[model samples]
Target: MLYAYLLSVVRTVAPIAAGWLITQALRLGVTIEPGPVESLVTGAFAALYYAAFRFAELKLSPRLGWLLGWARPPEYPRT
Candidate 1:
């Protein structure tokens, strides 16, 4: 149960963490001389971050909510 909860939280926050890291990296000093390489790297990182975030929200949100108490799990249908 504890592991499940922890995973849920991590899943929710992982993308944000990645995005923050990328943003910081970009802001601190992106001395990558203007070129397609810089744009490619930045765009790739942004896309990866967004994709992770989107997948987590779409696939794990309900489980996360239930695990974190933001919402309840649906009751199983009875026979």
Candidate 2:
């Protein structure tokens, strides 16, 4: 579903975005340049982290059901 796709994209991008912000902050105080290679590595690591997180969530869903309360309920369940 659209929601799932959006969540996946957010999860994948969040760490890379955070890394970029942190690097920018450090650059203000230090002479550090995260060039294209660093960006690519960061993005690759972010995707790996997202995949691991999603795998864990799916594997543990039964015990983590409470964390997923935001999902839509069955359409016919409510009166």
Candidate 3:
């Protein structure tokens, strides 16, 4: 549980970094002005993208093994 919780923090921050990257690309390639509204839309879209993938990796496909940021699986003791 703790492993997942820690991994979840990485998952949460990844979207923000991706959002900034996307926003920079748009600013360079497209003529759209960088403002609050543009940032807001990019942030929402990045969040959605992360949510979709996270859901698929964790819920839809469990066998893929840490497609996100998880370095390894958690270890559990057996009796």
- On the 0 to 100 scale, the lDDT of residue 68 in model 3 is 52
In model 2, which range of ten residues has the least summed lDDT? 70-79
Candidate 2 C-alpha error for residue 34, in Å: 23
Show the colliding residue pairs in model 3: none
lDDT of 2: 0.66
Clash totals for all candidate models: 0, 0, 0
**Candidate order (lDDT):** 3, 1, 2
CA shift at 50, candidate 1, in angstroms? Answer: 13
For candidate 1, write residues 1-79 as lDDT tens digits.
Answer: 6776797999989979998986898899865566977887898998787666555656877545433334644464443
Off by over 4 Å in 2: 30-79
What are the per-residue Cα lDDT tens digits for candidate 2 across 1-79?
Answer: 6776797999989989998997997789965566966987898898787556556556755344334443322243322
Residue pairs clashing, model 2: none
Error of 2 at 56 (Å): 9.2
Error of 2 at 52 (Å): 8.5
Q: Candidate 1: TM-score?
A: 0.39
- Residue 31 error for model 3, in Å? 22
> lDDT value for candidate 3?
0.72
